[model samples]
Target: MATELNKGPMLGQRHVQSFLLFSAITVNFMTKFNAGVAVVAMTDAESTNPDFPEYDWDEMQRSYILSSFFWGYILTQFLGGWLCRRYGARITMFASTLGSAVLVALVPWCVSWGGWQAYCALRMAMGLFQGFVFPCIHAHLANWCPVNERNRLGALANMGIDCGTLVSMFASGLIAASSIGWPGIFYVSSGVGIFWCIMWWFFGADTPGESKLISEAERSYIENSISSSHKAKEGHAGTSIPVPWKAIWTSVPFWAYMITKCCQSWGFSTLQTEMPAYMNGVLLMDMKKNALYSALPYFASWVMAVVYLIIADILLTRNIMSITGIRKTINSIAFFVPAAALIGVGFLDSEQKTLAVVLMCTNVGINAGSTIGSTINTIDLSPNHAGILMGIANTASNVIPIVTPLLVGIMVKDNHDRQQWQVVFIISAVIFVVGDLIYLAFGQMVTQPWDAPDFLDKERSPNLQEEGYSKALEAKESTNVDEAKRKEIEAGLESEEPKKKALNDEL
Candidate 1:
């Protein structure tokens, strides 16, 4: 009753989905950090463009604005996971991108009307929607990518973070300096996000089976390769898998991974939110040069992520190292190297500008290894629960961004004081080192027992089983088939008819 489909093209529909996912992330981060770049222009003592109004917001107010996005961001992580499970990643991501884009476009008007308070509220609302991003991404990856290709595909999708940051940081200053001024930054990001939403609406699919464009062979390949276990099969439909709450909370490896994420967040937030200020105060760079230098590190990070992805694929495919070994090894390098680089960054003064830039680049660039490390390990642990795991971890981790800016505002009364920044950098470095050690001690790459509690159960819902069969049938129907192939499929369907009747009777 079953037939083997021929393999499809080397670059299949999955890659197209990956590219769209990548573009979505790129647009998301552009919206996320547009404020980080725009704020510098907003608060400058003298406006480069006389047509735009500059606010006289103090350091504390600026910090609040910068951190406001995370305030709402922390509230929606668990909600995002639930949404992704109930609906699908495609729809969840669409809502996030569209809502965030609309909010971003409203920012300038909000700031003009209610001042900093209104601006913060808008950013928080944007954060609430954008919070769905990573959970949806992980959930989508789990459903779409095969086990053998997870590393490269995951890296390709997540690389958008660096690419988005690089593009936004570099272009924001130039856009602000142009005739359109700082408002152009928001408008541009919003426009790109809306464009992506349009593309995704037409093309994005939750699973290969759901896609009209995916070939039968490609769909079969992805589904078969991913569905190695009962849990994997269940996860493919975006069904609501039962949450193992006690098991997840009590898991030591999960906690270790969460701690590592938190630590990385602290270090990452410190640099991402504060780098513009650092360049302005300490390096004495103008907005344009500051943007260029700030962007360079993320460019390096993007490059390094690709390199890490290739190396990781080689190690796995060649069996040079186990997945566990590769994860820990790359994670250690990501954490320790960045920690050392950050310390070096702290000690350098304005006089050592070139060296400071180099170290900053190293600190950010080498950190890309973490993307290959703990980021996608949620899927490795439990494909069925990857979205929920990502949600829990991200909820805890994003708190650091909210707190880091407020702490920096408190600790550094004068941004020009090198000693003050030195303290901040040292704290971040210490966190990075400590986090990696915990991960090295307790992290795992193998699937957990809790991934499928239904494994031992002999009976499953007949309705669910029928639903899966119908989806496979639909996928077969959507593919272009020759007369002979159609005959074969019709015969296969005829053979499956009795089994389908039995399933319906059982239901």
Candidate 2:
């Protein structure tokens, strides 16, 4: 039997999972983006604060370093989804985080052994280990979060990205400025990742049922609120369902999501990895101030992400707008606004440093609205296959991370050249607009037919639609019979009434 929903507090074991996931993500991104900051610290020739010698790495080598991680990142995306489906989200996420932590801890040693080559190798390994993060999170959230809470919870979890970037930017600068130098950034980040893994292992579970910590009422409410087909019932071990690869591949809305995600990734990747470098190379900012500048945009992004989440939830809960309308509107703001901001950034000169910082802040801050748009759409499209769908979409989109840095590296042969930087921003803005247009045209928020566990079987069975029609016909006939009986009773009453009137006249 379906459990009735309580009208009170929504927090419980599920929220714990969200918080654990958030911590893990924060650590994950902290380690992932440590390189973004460390590279700036490592390469900045003008910085006198470093205790260790700075590398004379040019634009191309740094690009190579930044892009190498995605090579391994892209390799494991599909596998991550598969693992999430087979082993459950808890184990996959655990493995990803733990392995990434171990690899991150080893990065300094690896760099000592092989210089840039070793650094790139270690970064790739880190990506390989961490590639499962998104698919696993999607899979986990699918089980734990009810439809009504999906937007708010998912956005909250992803806010870790902003927080992580902020910390990495701010901390890396101060640490690099200290006697510990550039390597301290990696050590501190790795330590945090390791700590988060320990917490996750103890507190995290794949589903509410698996969790010993969740109250029975909340567990029942969660199970009953989400689609029953997606959850395993009592006394039964959950089994993996087959993926509808064909339908997913053919899905128009999914492709729109893919395109938009790729566009966002490009802009995000370019800004995240390159922004600190831009601050150092173009604006001639010191390492500490560079970190502060890099951190500010992410802080704003985090704040706006929460704002978008609140608005989204209100619109959804109150029926103020349809899901599709809200998604499109929020997504448009995310893309179009950022697109304009980036153009403004491209046009700014060195004298306009303050204006440039503001534009950069606006670019990332508004992009946070996408947390409500494309980020949660996988669940909307297919609650059952959310993980796999996310994997497929992310796989298609992850190509951007590989391409963006390399392209930026090539284009900005001289990092100090503002014209080259302007071209990069304009190109990114164009991609963002193009992606937004595609999403507006083809994006859908409703569940697709291919989301069913039996969708493949139904496709193979030629008589399925016919069988549905037959059932409908039977129901229609039954309704017709009842209607005919009702009419006959009305006719009998009418005839009796007329006869009674005639008898009264005769008397």
Global local distance difference test of model 1: 0.88
Candidate 2, which ten residues in sequence have the lowest lDDT sum? 1-10
Candidate 1 lDDT, tens digit per residue, 227-311?
A: 4353233444447456777778988889998999999999988998899898888888888888899999999999999999989
lDDT of 2 at 396: 74
Off by over 4 Å in 2: 1-10, 45-48, 234-238, 463-507
Clashing pairs in 1: none
Provide the lDDT at 226 for model 2: 87
- In model 1, which regions exceed 4 Å deviation? 1-7, 45-47, 228-240, 453-507
lDDT scores for all predictions?
0.88, 0.84
Lowest lDDT 10-mer window, candidate 1? Answer: 228-237
User: Candidate 2: how large is its RMSD?
Assistant: 13.7
TM-scores of the candidates in the order shown: 0.87, 0.88
Summed backbone clashes in each candidate are 0, 0
